[model samples]
Target chain A: MKAFPAIAIASGKGGTGKTTVAIHLAALLAAQGRAVQYLDCDVEEPNGHLFLKPKMERSESVGIPVPVVDAAQCTSCGKCAEVCEFNAIAMLKKPLVFPELCHGCGACALVCPVGAIRETSRAIGVVETGRTGTIGFAQGRLNVGEPMAPPLIRAVKARRNPDAIALFDSPPGTSCPVVATVRDADLVVLVTEPTPFGLHDLALAVDTFRPMGKPMGVVVNRADDDRRVQDYCQAENLPVLAELPDDRRVAETYARGELVFDRLPEWRDRFDALWSRIEECL
Target chain B: MKVVITSSNKTLADPIDMHFGRAKFFILADTETGKAVVHDNAQNLHAAQGAGIQSAETVAKLGAEVVITGSVGPKAYKALQAAGIKIALLEAVCPGTEALRRFKDKELPVLDKPNSEGHWV
Candidate 1:
């Protein structure tokens, strides 16, 4: 059996249509009788399932512990605060923790000489698995006001099937979330608009991916039937795999939570070509 | 008088770290009056796997007298103090860059004591 190809769709900035492209790509692959696993790693604001609408089959919670100091064991020595790297512990006279700043590494307990710190799990998000026809879907839903997302993203990726084409829908920005989603990708397809802001963020995304040593290509979402995006791609040596012009049909289809490939048969050919290029590179 | 933040490699600017190690980076800023340098190493270097002990040593080598950063788990803190590196625990900020910049500007509110947790969110 051939190895399943894993492709991640990411954008440096939000609102550039990463999920929109991911949905169509999954549909395109499933149309070709290939089993695909669609993972929504944007735990902060997962929206891929909004379009795919897979049926939930399994769900699990992802949690990280926020250490609680046993004041009885605490000698007011300020040792816990002394060893913490995140500044989560505040030990001027009494040691306290700021939950939002905690990464739950449990280093404080290990470092504490008195062993005053004990860990309790804090629920950060939920990973849900569902199925839509032949496509398997998974998504991480982050709790409101949680600062961390990478841990939950990694949790979703860990559940990915080795034999299914993993189509990852990454969160926006070139920060930790995007890095978590794209780090192990076989190929990264950056979907961006044709404006200055789009190009600016696209450059940042390219820089983020450059370190991973992965093959990347750009898919111009709403190419505007213009040359601005094309010129930038040409100058940057980035291959423009597909030009999705600004079309009301695509927009209308997307707004109704419908897959673009289902509405437009011709676009499936373009998606297939992009997939083939990525496969060849791998 | 140079400020050096050393990760395992020289790539601290990436913002998104893959290492999740005990050390993220050791930020070393030169002191004008004192002969010592100021620095802080990331708490759990392996969790983020970002920076390591080498980064802290680099900061110490730069002659930093004081170091301002988030947490420094006990083992690393002892080593830094043994090297005569004064430690200051910085107030946690969501964007670590802003917290680091405040330290450079001498505007960061720092705690004279160490923190009680491992991860810096």
Candidate 2:
């Protein structure tokens, strides 16, 4: 299947400014009269909405199918418990179902002899959709203490506006949730800093996405006197799309939940150039 | 009354497995009949998640009225409580016979809540 035209703004480490780049790009594109949708796939702790501040027009709970055993029809066959790979099901004097441990694979239901096991939707998280202005917006919010995030991330993607360009603000790290968000992206803008930790984690992020065969570019956030990040990008043959110099005003503006382009007109040009470079790379 | 003690080995002389969910063996001791059987817990020992909950069920299925372990997580504590099995805390790595003696003597501290957080972060 042909994947959607989406750009995932990802960082290997947290607070390296993946959402910083994502919201700016969305704002820049929307102001330019380009149809754009800001989809925050960082369900664990989505911050794009803090800046976009979308007026929520719709919100819905996302759920996964969990097995609900019917004891009356069960013949103590233990098929449900035996077929469960996660040990979510246990047959004692009676069958015990652990919904939290269940991955909702429905293997037990498939193996049930008298169809005693039925699947039921158990809410895990929520996906909200709305718009701030010309920019359509969506973000996934995983329930507190929920072990999984991919399902909520997928829920946000499924809520993407098909008519607009998708800018996915992904969660940090190259884990399952990150992979789920960026796997189908047409282009990925990897944001990073210039510190040793940033450089090392950037390489880890690059290694992670390189195998997926998706084209990627680097955007150095809080760029400073350190040249390691630039040198690493050059050596890896990856394009440095844009670099935002370290500025105290940028951090202050971010802390106040305001967009950099709005509060600081001087920074608008930087994001403008970033959008152009991203378009060429895409 | 039957009590399940987490064991690293089948014999009573072996050290108790500190980890409850992933314990190598569950020593199910019947205080009334003076009989105890060691059940293999390799399945829950290597479970992807919720090993504690599954282990609680394992002991409950073995007709245990009490689960004696080193420490218990929230899920396992709840599961054991729901099954009408009282959870008692004893320091892990001691001899299973020692735990059995404590269980029989009613000298172990009963867990009011989970001793540790879940394995998942």
Candidate 3:
């Protein structure tokens, strides 16, 4: 099999089975005696751990630099506020910083004339690593109320093992976080259902990834339920890698936080064949 | 003294906007001269976040002595208070000029604390 350094499984709409496809593919590859590492880049609401069941070995805090003010050395010139593109800082009588709004781009600190502005780290999320059997796993969990997720997603992706076949489970939607996860992947597998909403968002996801000049394939989940996704993929000249039929057993196993392969071992051969189809695309 | 009123349009006859930060325009009315000018608030209207704080900064920069609006968020209220700008809360939706008239008549109550939570904008 050809080596795919990183494969990002993304969907424009949520609950289209991004995690399910990602975990099953990784588990199948690991079962084939191939080294596989799964990185769940859905920092806002990562759930791959539920199925992979990795025993978390260690976790670390992720932070972004926010501006800090030195009133003693300060002149309230309002330069920091003027430089802030996010309106995270205000200088009414004194410099006031809204850390939540800050993107931590360090524009304020860079523009501060009197050296009154300094950067301080504020934790936005956490990254955890562990293993599920032979498969390596890592996931990012964004802190509640945190507006940004791209930074933490980047942190999670940075932990990817180059030697292993890294599979990234991306966040839904064609947003910044999704772009951050899929940007560096060798191949992008777009997952979608057979409904109008699915096709609409899948088109959006294609528009987003098409500009990046990366090879992409489509995986229609609940394959027999809807024909629109298949029609759309055929019209777009995108390969339909594998079509897993709508199965009650798959859904039930997923609800119980169990891998489909664990309950129906026969599905392992299907996932393995799915990898073969993905390899044919490359 | 200069007073700022959140408005849905440039004219004083327009209804006072319910949201302070996302208001379409801010009417800077001079109580002494009975004259008013409109400041466009398009930037903050579509701001991803911190719209309230940005609007408050605009009010402070305009050197307004008071702000008359339907509702003010906690962040904007605090910023306005720090700038020594009094907040006058409107009990009902009405024209910008009528809100100003209510303020002048002392019929509108002063906001001692924020009446709305942050991100209400």
Candidate 4:
């Protein structure tokens, strides 16, 4: 069976309605009797569960490999410290390993002359899997004060169901976590506002990921009479997928942890139209 | 006693850098012999993380028994303390020579705790 396209909903700035677009898209796809799995890759602070209210039944702790030094077999040669690019290891009398600073590159263990260093799992976050009605849902929650998010993001994305359509709710900004989310996606839907600030960040998002050469389109959220975003998308040859109206009622429904397509019956047609545009992009 | 002071440049007249991790240079001085050496620290300035720890390692490897700086983060403070190095905390916006002068006069406060948080830019 041909798998449905994996769509990643992303934004250059936070609170740009990336999750708002993603959950809505997932809901629309499921409404069409198609299998849908929503992967919330914003591990640092995932909020989609608020709307979907998925009953997470299974959870697994996620971690990266940090070095465990064997003192008996070790010397104070400081070879591990020399090879570490992240400064995760240090030579304090004997070699010291700081788990928080470690990136799990395994270079320290590789360079150990005595083979004293071994890899051990250092738990950084947790990934939970569940369902919101028929829609499969998974989200990564980075432990408070966790220095990195990409590892946990990868873990969350690993739960993507290939048999169903995958919708990735990416973290804000065009950084590593965002890249990790949209890297394997068949389509990336950039949800943006219509003001000048939105245009500036949209340009940044375009510049950062356009080189990746993924098929991308824009959905103007909270769109009013602003023509800046539409004009910029046209000039860049980027498809303007849809324009979500700046409706106060939509915000009121959102504040109560509700879905736009559910509360605002008229909005269902808009989301359905969005899925049509997404299929066109694919 | 050997003392390491974070500095902006190689010269003793230059003001001591307020930031320990991103400091441009380190002046290692022998209190008894009145001799000192300048060590370049351009590598740790752009380091993404653990700059303070690596800087502390440099200070330790230089055989400096005492560290006098504007402030140090928790990692640097712990690293230096682990190596049995005495740390004196000073907030003076002065030259390395002046800092040393105050150190000799016992005017600067010796640190028993880290004054700043980690990732100190």
Candidate 5:
């Protein structure tokens, strides 16, 4: 299968317009007759479909290994406690495990000389697939109380179509979840606003993604706050792909769960140019 | 006859039982001999979502006679008790290690009420 050119739209801040840019890019690519697979890797709070309104299709559960104790074949040696790095096991007076902190490493089962520990599968999230206008979409939703989101994000990416251009709507942050989503991307578009908070987080995002050595650019959303965004980009030699004006129409369209590119039409043209620039960079 | 510690340092294995799991590290030590073995559940590599279940099995697998740790939650504490794995919540890590040393010296602290929420992070 031909590998899809994966692009991840990420931001350090939560509301820096990553999703908005991702939605528009998907729409623009689809309009250009490109088969685009839009993936929402923000398992914690997926709002991409709100703008695209894709039809629902299949949903599948994503799970990871959890330990199961076997009392009958147990020696109570407590070797499993020594190997675990997270301190998830309480073994002094009585043996117990806290499920929330487990990382599913399987070392406990391996270290258990008595074979009292075994791994069991537990569901942690769900992935939903469907269509959002011309784009095929997939989103991972972490099960309530699940601390990790990377595994689910990986599951969503694993389902991507190789022939399609996979545009990832990544979670907000340079944390573990964000790294997991964009680690394999060919290019990363960092979407940010022209505000103090936006710049601060963008700086962090820059640090996180810079180490990957992948080609990256910035898209300033609602750039009416100040010229600092452009200034910083200029000083840092980061290309400013597009500057979305602070327009009321875009805000209204966002509130109504619609993509501005579809209604404004002009934004689509801008995205086309941005895509071309990305291709040139790659 | 046995006590547990989460430390993997064999040099300090006296009075400590080293056990590893997917979630956390623990130690089980003997008060009389000061012989300790480290136990780590953090090694289990299971998702953090099922830490409780993974921790329980880790203790059972190690065959730990007594377990000691910085803290523990209610669900795991209860399950450990039901499994006949004795638990001790030392308010301080030093005290837990000291208690293990004392246990090696034939002195042991009586197990007290397990903290419901766990050790303060």
Candidate 6:
């Protein structure tokens, strides 16, 4: 068995082709006879499933334990409220727990003097696993109105297969959810375009991931659209792994839930080269 | 009956604050004695989340039977309602004392549902 390297595809700004690059790379790798696992860590709105078209095998609910107060045992001491940093718990003659605002740190339960506070798991999302040919596919779907995504993202990442290459499709921006997706990845591919917004957010993502001491490379989608991305990469001494052309066909195919490698056979070589460059960085 | 009104300033002549959760002060006044006490709500003004819930808890702890404000979010409305606090909407910006007078004279309308969306503050 070969040691599988986990690579995370992330972007600073949304719609920068993170999913487009991830699914293509995963498909190309699996086509090369290597076992691969594709995990969509964008729990807020997972879309990789649309392209992968994996069979719906099974799903497991994910949740965090929120404190529930027993009114009969509660003395209205206000200690639970005082210990809550998120202000999720409040005592107004009785303890009231706002589950929406809770981070599920369980501090309130620990501080309850009367042992009135107990934790109850509230479902926030679900992790679904299936297969697209030989490629393992998993994604997290956060329930509507649920504010938290890190817990579900963690659940998705926990399904990582050490026996195969793991490719993670992280959510946009440099928030906590993105961190949860790319934290321990072997290599992080920062996808960007040749635009001011892309460069600005790319810099923010670099600032966030660089401090973690992880090796990173940039992929400039719609490469011929602008030269600024290449110029920025050169100035920053970052490796340019792949440059995808700005083709309307690629966009149209993606919109129709199709893979670039499948629609355009010529691009399979390009994704194969992208994987090699990522290997060099690792 | 004790009434609480969100205010921008501590004085009775100050304008009623349009925001409920982020208001500077909550004036707790007695309808019969006309005695008003100002409770500073500066701590919750800078809260990143759940300011409305904390603000609702503050007034409920102060033993206010009624609340008068320009707008109320769902979380605060739920908390106030659970605390058995009657909510009255001012509809327009007016002096804090005027809002109290309207409440006493039955000119203000009771709010059964939240007027503004959550996180409005």
Global lDDT for candidate 2?
0.88
Model 4, span B5-107: residue lDDT tens: 8999997788999878778999999888889899999998888889988988898899998888888888878888777888887776798889998999999
- Cα lDDT tens digits, model 3, A119-189, are 99999999999999989999999999887899999899888887899999999999899999999988899
| Lowest lDDT 10-residue stretch of candidate 3 chain B | B112-121
Model 6, B12: alpha-carbon shift in Å?
0.6
TM-score of chain A of each: 0.93, 0.97, 0.96, 0.98, 0.94, 0.96
**Candidate ranking (lDDT, best to worst):** 6, 3, 4, 2, 5, 1
- Model 2 lDDT per residue over A1-282, tens place: 223368999989899989989998889888989889999999989889999999999999999999998878989887787788887777666678888888888899989989998899999999999998999999999999888788889899998877889999999999999999998899989999999999999999999999999899999999989999999999999999999999999999999999997888989999999877887887
lDDT (Cα atoms) of all candidates against the true structure = 0.71, 0.88, 0.89, 0.89, 0.75, 0.90
Candidate 3 chain A: 10-residue stretch with minimal lDDT: A1-10
Candidate 5's C-alpha runs over 4 A off are A1-3, A92-95, B1-72, B79-121
Would you list the rank order by TM-score, best first?
6, 4, 3, 2, 5, 1
DockQ for each model: 0.03, 0.57, 0.72, 0.76, 0.13, 0.70
Q: What is the TM-score of chain B alone in each candidate?
A: 0.47, 0.93, 0.95, 0.94, 0.62, 0.96
- Cα displacement (Å) at residue A127, model 1: 0.9
Question: For residues A34-53, what per-residue lDDT tens digits would candidate 4 score against the true structure?
Answer: 89999999988899999999
Model 6: CA > 4 A from native: none
lDDT of 6 by residue, B1-121 (tens): 9999999999889999988888899999999999999999999999988899899999998999999998989888888877889899888999998998999999999999988888733
Task: Tell me the tens digit of each residue's lDDT in model 6 across A30-67.
Answer: 88889999999998889999999999798999999999
Model 1 chain A poorest ten-residue lDDT run: A90-99
**lDDT pick, better of 2 and 5:** 2
The residue-level lDDT of candidate 4 at A180 comes to 93
Candidate 1 residue A228 Cα shift, in angstroms, is 2.5
Give lDDT: candidate 5, residue A101. 67
Writing each residue's lDDT as its tens digit, candidate 1 over B3-118 gives: 44333333334231222124455444343432322234444333332132333444555665555555654434544554565654444433334434665677755434435433
